[model samples]
Target: NYLWINHGWMGKKVKYKEEKFKITAIDGGWSKWSPWSICGKDCTHTKTRTCDEPAPSYGGRHCSGKDTIVTNCTGGLCEN
Candidate 1:
């Protein structure tokens, strides 16, 4: 649940400053309302998925085979 304290959707491109937010949990799968995942470099692995297993970059919960999970796609690889 996010609180849009101040609405900046209509602002100009230069006025916009992107902020990093983490996806605490997933609601089954990534539909339109999938929470943003941005928890440092360490991603919280689900119970079914082992810690040794690498998380997929752009994949849903029921993903199979080798997947690529980009950890910091939201705010870039390095924090500025």
Candidate 2:
């Protein structure tokens, strides 16, 4: 028996006897960061937040970068 499959609008016909396929899930992504923790007594402290995205699945692209980030705390008393 023969089977014909249309490749696309191009009207190309393809013949196949049998085909194999594999599927995989993507990597997981970082979840939303918790509230910023209290900064140190010093004004020169750091604050951070995180992403809350789900991880990728089924051989999908994995989350590449960091989940959390930190920034200088310039509004604290220490700054004075």
Predicted structure with the largest TM-score when compared to the true one: 2
Candidate 2 lDDT tens digits, 1-80: 56899989888999987665777565666665566655545644443433326656666676667655555565545445
Error of 1 at 2 (Å): 65
Error of 2 at 10 (Å): 55
Per-candidate TM-scores read 0.16, 0.39
The alpha-carbon lDDT assigned to residue 59 of candidate 2 equals 62
Residue 63's lDDT within candidate 1 is: 39
Q: Encode model 1's per-residue lDDT on 1-80: one tens digit a residue.
A: 33344447955334344678875532232222224444443433211222223333333254343333443343433343
| Winner by lDDT | 2
lDDT comparing candidate 2 with the true structure: 0.60
The C-alpha stretches of model 2 lying farther than 4 A from their native spots are 1-23, 42-61, 74-80
lDDT score at residue 43, model 2, on the 0-100 scale = 41
